[model samples]
Target: MANISQLSEEERNDIVQRLKRIEGQARGVQKMVDEDRECGDILTQLASIRAAVNSLNGELLEAYLLRCIQNPDDFGSPEKAVQQAVRALVRS
Candidate 1:
């Protein structure tokens, strides 16, 4: 399928920035493991990373729904586009 959603440059940059921060967190977690840090501390950092990822997922979902609303023709009708958006959310 063709790309159905197109986000602005700022939105795309925000996502890239978030991914970079997550990457750094992952490396820090690895370092903590290598240094034999407290288990609780490592788990805390892992939880943070997971939460950040979930936040990004939410932003993408919102973007998809908005795109579906904007380009209902792509899905045949507005109602169908809504259905598609609902399905996307459910799958997510």
Candidate 2:
């Protein structure tokens, strides 16, 4: 598998912030469970967290395609790299 290129400082910071927010959401879900909150409410929160994680994955995949797979200079076979990445993404 081709390695992902390094993210720019701004991109890294943004991803970190998004991850932190997700972490908070996870904690909130735990607290809700401990407090015996409604199952519906907890499931909703879990769905939202899953969506957030999927969004993050999409962003990272886009960055990887553009920075690593799409650059001929960076990867010897750009098309192959893209195909592999797309297959992996689909599998996930």
Per-model TM-score, in order, reads 0.85, 0.81
TM-score of 2: 0.81
Compared with the true structure, what per-residue lDDT tens digits does model 2 show for residues 48-78? 9999999998898777666655564555576
Model 2 worst lDDT run, 10 consecutive residues: 67-76
| TM-score leader | 1
Model 1 lDDT per residue over 1-92, tens place: 11523677888889999999999999999999999999999999999999999999898888888788888987888889989998989988
Question: What is the lDDT, from 0 to 100, of the residue 66 in candidate 1?
Answer: 78
lDDT of each: 0.88, 0.81
Candidate 1: give the clashing pairs: none
